[model samples]
Target chain A: MTINSKIQNINCCDHIARRVGDIAPSGIRKFFDLLASMDGVISLGIGEPDYPTPYHIREAAISSIENGYTMYTPNSGIPELRQELSKHLKNTYNLDYADSQILITVGVSEAMDLAARALVNPGDEVLIPDPCYVSYSPCVVLAGGVPVMIPTCEEERFEISAEKIEPLITEKTKALLIGYPANPTGTIMPREKLEEIVKLANQHGLIIISDEIYSRLVYDCEHTCIATLPGAYENTVFLGGFSKAYAMTGWRIGYAVGPASIIAAMTKIHQYTIMSVPTMSQVAAVEALRNGETSAAEMVADYNRRRLVMVKGLCDIGLSCFKPQGAFYAFPSIKNTGMTSEDFAHNLLMEEKVAVVPGNAFGRCGEGYVRCCYATSLKELYEALERMERFLKKRGASQAATFQV
Target chain B: MLNKILRLLEDDGRLTPEQIATMLGTETSQVKELITQAEKDGLILKYKAVVNWDKIAEEQVWAIIEVRVTPQMKAGFDAIAERIYKFPEARTVMLVSGTYDLAIIVTARNMHEVASFVTHRLAPIEGVQGTTTHFLLKRYKEDGVVLDDKNKGMRQKVVL
Candidate 1:
């Protein structure tokens, strides 16, 4: 058939699912497209670490392949990986999970999808913090569930308190989704505050999906796994991975741990959809868990240095930023410029060739800020800061002139 | 904190006290004071460059001389090692554990100078029994810094 006739015959829109069409495209993607067409742009828009996977971990993967481990693993993942993950969770958080309670995934991204799909029925509401990672709401939507956003503000250090979450709960609420050492803001939820939410969830008979992918990247504070809290283990699905810690993002490996029934439910969906994570990646992840601690600590130290430089530079440039205690981003408020986050990002990209993500890309409450990732080299970060300073000064001068007029 | 500052200075001696302070989030005076105290304590001896002189027009010969030395009563290899290290031509001297008792790095104006130093000076010592000299033709890396490919970009321009 001719191409036009074939397209017409398919009636693509009718065939497309309503839920898929309703999901909004990522707000960061358009800026990426513009950035691709431009030259000499210094971007602070990336969310992942700039470091390559630690050499030993990569070597482990290479040897795993050389030893002929290139087949699909069990639906629940390899036993050794699961055992290591169990040990890791126990050793790090003092939380115990048998291997049967853990399932390896293609990343926290897949684990999140499985959790949503297995738990949410049609119209069940999942309460999530506003200005969260871009995928949380979409995953809930795709699972035929409603995502109710609990708006958090900079005053609370962007933490979702129980007071804010309690009032939002209703009979239809099924789960609460949270990620700490959260993306875009780098705010970590304190342990006491997490316990408050856990209590609330228990009272309301709600599940909690805690994404701890950035758990190892925390600076100046300890990360609390919600599963370890009193009365939370059976109700919490703890999602973690080696991506941020081991610099293994491209490996696409993560795992989830919880009660056996919930994991089995998720695995039932996973068996048909994704059978297993890559065998080589799982072997690499095992090696990372076994011996990658030192390299991970070194990367965290480097990130801490860059974080100070970026945060201080942003504050010096007239954008007030909170001291992020974890993760690699510095979220600075741009409200003084009298421009929307999108316009600020666009104009800065156009004028000074420095790319930063508009904060609203994360959520509605992220309106007056922009997320600047500081995981790049110190030299590039300083250069980006200089360009941003120039852009801010120009905008400030123009705004002052408008006021005078 | 002081050890961290010392490590940064050790990695790159060119970093000023103010730069180190900014990087470490401490006062510049504190870094200066700690470094000065460390210098007085002899924790840091001296700062020197690891240069690849072959890149320049200047010619300097470098040789690694393995020396077999007879051990003294109490000093072991210390007496002979001190004698070899006393010469300015001997860049480095170490008591080794293998077939050689002392490994000495000697730099000179030419091969003749190195030969003279080995035969005339190094061999004449009472404890010095035998010697083997190996000339260094090129230096690919020194002091953990890659000498060649200085212009090669180590950091990617962009990454996620």
Candidate 2:
């Protein structure tokens, strides 16, 4: 059949479900698709680290498969994995939780979806910071909740202040979703900011969902958990994964820790839905959280080195960057270029073949800026900088004249 | 008198000679002379009312692309860079000093088109190194004023 005839026979209207409107394609995924076909493109757009999964972690997965441990794990997760996760939380963030408060998920992505479904009632409002993780809003919407975005500014290094968050609350505001070591912008909340939010949540009786997937990837400061703050442990649901620190994006393993009540609700939903994370992945993650400290240490050290280089490089190149307190990413202002974030990023890709995510992609506040992930090798990082310099020299005339070239 | 009229309209072209003379208390002949001089100096190219497209609802997709490239190639960085800029996906380009060399902006109907550009068009070019792609997770304000925050939360939410 001809293409037109095939199209005619298929009922496009019938195939499109109402949920499709509620669930739109991710903007980050869209850009990756564009980059797939283009030649000579250098990208700092994806949040995932470029490092290979550490050898020991890989071996653990291999060992699981070899030992015939490929069978399904417990609905909550393997006992050892949950225990390790529990221990890691107490050790790192001073946040205590029993294994029962944790549920191993396919990834933090799954944890986010499950949490939304478990907590959000239809039409309930979820207060997500503007320029948040791409997954949060969609997940909230899919769970039949409304996403109310709260704008954060660059002056605050994109860190949402509690004062800014307090007034948005209402009777219908069911939860507050916050991510630190933020993806598009490498901003992390200080203890003071978390304290304010914690207090406010307590006042309004709000649920606090913390996406701390980038916790171990922090460069400048230590990763602190809001759950550690007094009174927050019961209200906050902590989301974490082995992806950034262990460079295990493909492993698809993460866990959530929260109050026993919410944890029970999430586990019930998870049991009926995803069942459990892949057995090998759980094995790998357990190894990562427990025995993978050396690898995490080395990787974080390398990222810190690259982070310094990248932030300095962007500054030297005139894309002013605020010193990122945590995370191995830099969100640089592109305002001097006289172009929108999308325009700046597109031009950089087209002209210099260098790719960065536009600030606007994260939210309107991200306009006139772009995000650069320094989770790459020193060699790739420097070379990408050189190409960017040349491109900006030609495109950004005022800034170009200062270049030695 | 003619200067006052021009200043009021911000340009001589916006008003006919008769209108300007009536408004400024000047003769039509003098108004015409002032218009001719302003045009000769290249101060005014054309007079048109600026249209704010933001007011209209349009199906628009925006993306920020991170790109990597080899600075010094066998042929030179310019040729490879040129190839990247030539693609329709590129709307803006900049060379940055960081983990990646160049930052690009691209727009398309959907995610598939952006992906095609990366895999099919970009990665294969000579001297083209590596790339990590990030799609916009959310947007708060685009040009200047708040765009997405219909709810007033001074503190923004971002997940890196």
Candidate 3:
């Protein structure tokens, strides 16, 4: 019997699961598509690094593949990776986590998904700060949970104080998801503020899913790993990965360390969904853990230099950018242009061929700003800054605001 | 701070004090002062570009010469090395510890000029004992930069 390839009678979209339908598609994708058709555009919109994976890490993967280590290991991860990562957390933060408590996922992205799916029940509310990484709230929504966003702004340094969170907490609030060296804002939560959040989490019996993917990217500041805080270890699902720190985004490796029950639950979901991360990537991660600090430090230094230029350049162009403490992005206030964030991003891309992400794509509070990643080479960054300055001046010439240039 | 400034300038000698100060998050005056001190102390000798002369449509030939030098009584190889380096044709000269006592790279308009310099000027020096010259063929890289490299566009114009 011939298969009927055409089922024109039904629309496949209608039958999509309710939870899947609830999640909105990433808004930046359309912006990127429009950008794809253009030429000679200098982009500060990429979230990943311009640097390729360090040579030694790539060699490690090459050797691993040559040795025919292609088969899957345990569902959690290869034991060596888990052990190295465990020792890493201990040495870095003094947080004691045995290898059993760490589960290596595809990336921090997958770890976030696994954490949300494992913990959230129907109608459970996950308290996430607004202007967070775009996936946090959607992952919760996909897990049949409601996401309660506590809006944060530049006045607070975009920090989520427990006082603001306290008013949003209900009995249904099951977890507090936070990422520092946060996306868009680059706000690294201070230890005192983290302590307050830990206290709040304990009092409410809430789980804290902390994404510290940018933990190593802090400029001139020590990162406070929340799990090391008093009473936070038991409640925090600490997410970390090599993507940001080691210039290893393409390697697709990250880890989640937490209390036994939460880790076991996350592993349970992970085993069924993704049996294990790629063995070669895991080997690369092992190399990254064993010998990657010096390399990571060098990359961080390079990014720090670019960060200085980027912040100063944005301010020079009269965009009023905040001095991002960590991460590769600079979120600058674009409200003075009398254009919405989307309009500013689109018009800038169209008129001047400089691509920046509309900040509101991250969350509601992200409006009136735009996220421009500074991980590109210094030459490209300089050229992009010049183009942006010209774009702003051309606009300013038409409007009431006159630029310094 | 001095080393950081040196590194920035060494990478791209054209970077202005204001630009380096902006990149390092230091004051322009501090960078200028540090640069002045560095120059006065002879810590930074020269600011020059590493050019791939092959790309310039100009005739240039380079030779790597291994010179076995006779050490002087008091100054050892230093006096001889300096004497050889003082020649305007000696592009790079060093007293290297190896089979050869002195290693020098001499650049001239062509093979004839390099041969003449070696036989006439270099070999005739007091401490110069034996010299073996190897003509340079091509330059794949120069000064920590790959020459004539095509742009490898691995990254998308935009990414999540």
Candidate 4:
């Protein structure tokens, strides 16, 4: 055979699949690329915890490795982990998910992909609230499903209510997808709102794809697991993880808890594509579920305190921040600055060495805002706020205006 | 609100009352008043740096002396622990459980100084039965702050 030096004479773009080619690259990526080459940036961009995994939980994984558990695990993950997760769900939300109905994947990212792929037929439509986590709409589109964006306004605290969603449902509507406490916004859907959405889904004969990655990060307010609501369990795919609460993002471990049929379908896809999550992560996750409540609570408490600081800091800088009920983000309004979210982010990074993700990275409705994650240390948060105030002072947004949380 | 203010100061004592007020979403006057009351009530003690002295030129030898004592009438180990902790060289003093009755940390300029204090000052105390002195070799962590900070700022600056 003749050896070929290059795969294509023209461009690699021609070889890309139509479905994959159509998905827009993340809006935050270009800014991140710029940030990578910069120095001394205090970032409030990433939706991740700054803390490391707790000592005991990490030790569990180490002990598992020492016990010679280096091989691939079962496709559905270790039975012990599944069982522990089942108990955890029941204990936390009073939802009954059997061990067989829990499907472990490589983080909730994979779990969402699996859910979309397993449930979506070509041309089906999935209703999603605008300004959600970036992956929500793309997951649907990549699965050959149409994403119908429902605009949720900032006036109503960017809430995902049923009235904003019911009008979007049509015959092809396959699911109602939501993530709360949402990334970039930190908006937690109230129990009543989730119930309304679940009820609307029931009426439309649609499934509910709920990404509850930040379920444990609620501040002062309690997290309402939609699946725990009456008659909502069978119709919802509940995605939870050890990332935010346990600070185990590097471990790449998450799972989906739902009805047996849906889980079986997701498992079928997971088995062929991933085979299994990392065995050590599975071991560590089991420990997280079984004995990590105190660590999770401590992390959430820390996040709550930082949440207060972030919101107050933003408001103090004259960028009115919407008080986030959950997660570690404060989505502050930048409309008064008369600068596009992208320009604000870029300028702030360039001028003051403070990196923040522009709100439009989530969706169109996020245009006049920017998400500031409060999972950083208080010292860094203070420094970031000071730099941001200096940046905004030059832009005339630093008015020291009165604001309420 | 008072506890929240105290918690913020507990994490970093260098924070001013104004900064503490901003962080906890409260008033500076209120925080100041509460902090004043706390200081008066002994809830807020001296604010100082948690220095890793080993990294400095003026490093001192630390010795943990476990004193096994007989409980005296009525006063028990409290009277003895009070007497030991009163020493200026004693860094920490606690009445412990198990084999030891009192555990005291003694910091001195040299090992000889530490040994001299353990024998001359500590063993001479009332009701002191025996002593076990263990000299500290190295300190990797102090007051919840890791000395090396090797893993500081290693997390990815941004992610989806």
Candidate 5:
């Protein structure tokens, strides 16, 4: 063998950090990277809201930085910010917590990481719904936990049953991770379902971690937190963030609310690991929670409008879809096109210059689905939707022709 | 009966087996049975519902792989080809009619994956010669359709 080949072999054979190396070999960023380089592409690939951070919230960040509020606050986060977050949770979801029970992390994204790390012991089993948020299972794996996925069908509006979840539970199962106003599917959990799940968690002694980052973006109905149900606040960790509601995705601010003990554990990790969230970000988030209500409401209203338009537009174009109740996403079934989610997405981007993330990227349950984020502008949505229509019709017509010949 | 049913479903695209059955003076169950038989016979390759792509978010990628084999080694080209085709990254492997003997299509997240497949997975096999890898730059036709702008909104809105 050549020296180069020898070096390559040596590197391949050497043991690396086990957890980092085992990360599932796919993610949302991969598609975004492709979308970035492609010319004339209109992307609904990444779940970023098109709206800017509201004026008042941006101003708060600016004011904080200008006033030299640049130093780290507390490891758990700024007291006022956490207090505001507590109030926001109680007011919105009827979930009560003090600042001591809330840990202000970078975002709900970070809250997920913290929850996974804090609760997942090596080889502990974590149950996640398939067609899930792309990050959940990987985070579980990163924490040395095994993820058992339950497929949530499109016909059921992608809701996971307590019954479906019950079968997957075992002695090794330590936690149940649920993301409502879910990422790709846009399926929001109804209160009854949330209550049932909370009951299951309680019955089985499973820690329930609820990622409610998209809670504020519900279109068809109000979001209900699992933590709001009786007996849940003690065991459930509620993840809320400023990204979706406040259009502050790039700002990277979120919080987790739970029992004092779990909050303390996460806070200890944050103290050593991240020190504190950015000072200006915490200030901005505080303003977002307290003073940015009108702005968030207005933006959410717009997303709801776009949500309906895209759902209607997609179904009009012959794609099978359920109206998303929450989140700025529409998960549609692509099983009819005789292509895998990956194939459909690749063809769409390549042929139409419209980018989407494939369903399978989320999990195996996403096999015949694709997640289209309607988080773009109205013009972009209409244009991309039209392009998808054209792609499908043309494919349909040609297939028909081939059969006839 | 099966041939007629397959022909109708394939040509019309939207004809349900029930409709075909009515036209052919047979029961829907019989029509369904014929379609199933056609699929078993490989005459009807796939049954797919039409879907609009923009409704969901899906990530996609495409790559090409090249393989070199030790021509007269103990394990010949056939063995090397089998090994290359076994990787999940290898989507479709064909003994192509070209200057290169084998053509492989792979899909993955980014260049690093394609590179690793080439370096760690493809190159190290004992009888392998050399391989060429290409990230798909563009696709003019995928699944036999040119993704053009005109076809958008072809389906009328049906209330669900």
Candidate 6:
């Protein structure tokens, strides 16, 4: 047979698993692709911090390499990193986890995947707050589990209360995944609200995977680690990383802490798949945990400053924004514009060269909102806000003319 | 809050009060008031650019002149320092605590100008006893700015 005929004979889709095919393409990808091709487009679409890793942390990684720490670490992670993470968790959130109970992975991204694969069984359901980080649902689905999105509204500051979650729990519900301070919405689940969820998780015998990547980026609020709650220690898998806090997205180092058995199970998969995180990154993470707190705090302060500017700018421009208490994003409602989130984002990108992620990229409930990250430089944020203002004015004028007609 | 605003201005003189207010999460009027107060109080002396003139084709000479001057009865080195610093050529004059009594940084059009300023102008002063001039060969850094390559090493745009 000819090459074309032979290739056609080997049905690629048939060979692929049905689970892989069932996974939808990421909603954020199209915007990212459009962003990549466009020049001079000010983006509030990104989720990571703009700052480089702190000097001391980078210095540590360099010294580690010079010291010939090029070999692979233990499958779980370097003991030093795990120890520092344990101490860090204890100091930051008053949560105590033994070093053995922590598994360092390639950022919270990998840890989220590991959590799903380790705990989820086929046909099991994992409940997640709607409009959360994009990876949570896909991770659950990829692990042979069904993802159940619990709808959260802006009136409640996008917080998922126990009232909404408790009724959704069925026998097949194996876990509840949550990230706070949450991405896309930039809302932190307050301690009192989390207590309700903890009670529900306990009553329903469900594991809670808490992604606390943005824990340190909170503005004027304390990030209460769900694992630190009274009865949550046994059932909660806490995922955190240096990416958001230390501005170390490129470092690709994060840790997961939980019950020893769950950690061991995660480690089993990690060993077979990832084997180990980079030794240099592990060294850098240790340095970040040890000496990078001040720098992290400073970045958080900067983000807080930018957050105020962004939220205020959005509101001033007639997009009603729910004040973000945590994370760097400002999710503003675009309902008054008489456009869908996608149309607003796309038209704004086309007309004014400002790129923002449509909130629906996170989930269905995010339809009339848009996510604007304030982690960019103050100058960029100012320019983006200016462009958005102009765009809004023009849109309003056109809408008014249409209404008159 | 005012101190924080001052430090930010000190780092980047181009930051407007509006920008500072936004970054500091304060009202623009408040930042304006504090900055105006600071200016009136002489807390912020002046805003000046730190220029690296070595990059230009025009030749400029800088010399560090160490002077040993007899101390005045009442004024000590302050009188002599004031005398030396009054000249526009003396970029900086300090009563140093080293082997030299007074250290003066002199800038001129050329080496000859600097040498002449040291010999005919600086050394001829009443209290001056001896002089040693060291001409600066190159400036690696000036006022916390590296004078080497101008490129800040552009950061790669990352997407998550």
The digit string of per-residue lDDT tens for model 5 on B1-160 reads 7655665566555666655654454687987887778778888776675443433356555688766566546655677778888999987888766667778899877688888888898889877677888777765554534545464432211100
Error of 4 at A110 (Å): 0.9
- TM-score of every model? 0.88, 0.68, 0.95, 0.94, 0.68, 0.90
State the TM-score of the second chain for every model: 0.90, 0.55, 0.94, 0.93, 0.63, 0.88
| Each model's DockQ score | 0.29, 0.03, 0.75, 0.62, 0.01, 0.43
In terms of lDDT, the poorest run of 10 residues in model 4 chain A is: A1-10
Q: Model 3, stretches more than 4 Å misplaced?
A: A5-10, A397-405, B148-151
Highest-scoring model, lDDT: 3
lDDT of 4: 0.88
Candidate 5 residue lDDT tens string, A333-367:
78888898988988898899988888888888888
Using TM-score as the measure, the top candidate is 3
Per-residue CA lDDT of model 6 for A131-247, tens digit only, reads 988889999999999999999998888999899998899999999999999889988888999998999999999999999999898987788889989899999999999999999
- Candidates in order have lDDT scores of 0.88, 0.78, 0.89, 0.88, 0.79, 0.87
Rank by lDDT, descending?
3, 4, 1, 6, 5, 2
For model 3, the docking class works out as medium
Which scores higher on DockQ, 1 or 4? 4
Instruction: State what share of the real interface contacts each candidate retains.
Output: 0.26, 0.06, 0.80, 0.69, 0.00, 0.40
Of 1 and 3, the candidate ranking higher by lDDT: 3
Per-residue error at B135 for model 6, in Å? Answer: 6.5
Question: What does candidate 1 score on TM?
Answer: 0.88
Cα lDDT of model 3 by residue, A1-405, tens digit: 234545665789999998888677777778889999998888888899888888899999999999999999899999898888888888898888987789999999999999999999999999999998888988999999999999999877789998999999999999999999899788899899999999999999999999999999999889888999999988899999999998999889998999989899999999998999999999999999999999999999999999988888888778876688888998888888889999899999998899999999889999999999999988889999888888889877223222221
**CAPRI grade of model 6:** acceptable
| Pairs in steric clash, model 1 | none
